[model samples]
Target: MAKGKVGKTVESLGDYLREQRVASRLSLRQLAELAGVSNPYLSQIERGLRKPSAEVLQQIAKALRISAEQLYIRAGILSPDDGVGGSVELAILGDTGLTERQKQSLLDVYASFLALNAVSDAEFAADGDVAAEPVATDPPADTQDQDPQKITTEG
Candidate 1:
């Protein structure tokens, strides 16, 4: 598949899955065989005729060797979380043991975190006119043998 500029706009979950399957050179029947789902079912999923449950999504993801969360993200079901935390509602939804209430709680938290982080990002940009560029950090010569940090303890 051609790499598109807008990943979010370019792919529905089904479209992404179809692309991956095609890139892997697997036919629908082959993917269904590997995924242990019916060919028709997989086809419907690719056509966006159905919304896969988390369990089904996980099964497909496993066959594709990807995280179930990634499938949901591509499907536009969940947005990524922000802040210093590498987390989002999809992380919570991926947990099979969580009750409905727990999932709601996690989603609420993630949404709030995203909102707060958006504001923080705006503030940070406003603070400096510095263009964001890759800073060249030259490693010291023969640095491989040294401990990463000379002092581990904080002052």
Candidate 2:
């Protein structure tokens, strides 16, 4: 990432963290204790004077009862698109029972599903229809006698 971008990300992440902490009604020291980090370290993070590691972000997220992926996005560690599988990815990463390889495999599979859905959504959008009905076609021979008012297309 560019230096400027990184700086902006860190600053925004700090601001977001501060906002979450305040919204949770936790003081700086209280949040620091809950996150198991030093008060000064947390203060520095909130001030945008330090870039925290992923582990730290997770801890803070847990303390704030928010999604770690949100922090990851703000920190520029994960793109917004990646957030489609945010909580699932975090669970996979945090699971101690699964080996790293297993976690990676699961993540890959999950990502493939998200990608496939994205493609389908794009195609649907390109069709310029808000509904999911199929293209119009001739009525079946057996249904030709049915009243047109009784016919319906799936949405």
Best by lDDT: 2
> lDDT tens string, model 1, 1-155?
96453343334777889988988888999888888899999998888676666567778888887777778666544655433333556567777899756876777676787789889999988889877778987677767567887735658
Per-residue lDDT tens digits for candidate 2, residues 8-107, read: 8888999999999999999999999999999999999988889987678889999999988888779865667764557777777677798757866887
72: Cα error in model 2, Å: 0.9
Q: How many clashing pairs does model 2 include?
A: 0
Question: lDDT of each structure?
Answer: 0.73, 0.84
**Model 2 stretches with alpha carbons more than 4 Å out:** 1-3, 86-155
- In order of appearance, the predictions have TM-scores of 0.54, 0.56
Off by over 4 Å in 1: 1-11, 81-90, 99-155
Best-fitting candidate, measured by TM-score?
2
Model 1: residue 51 alpha-carbon error in angstroms: 1.7
How many pairs of residues in model 1 come into backbone collision?
A: 0
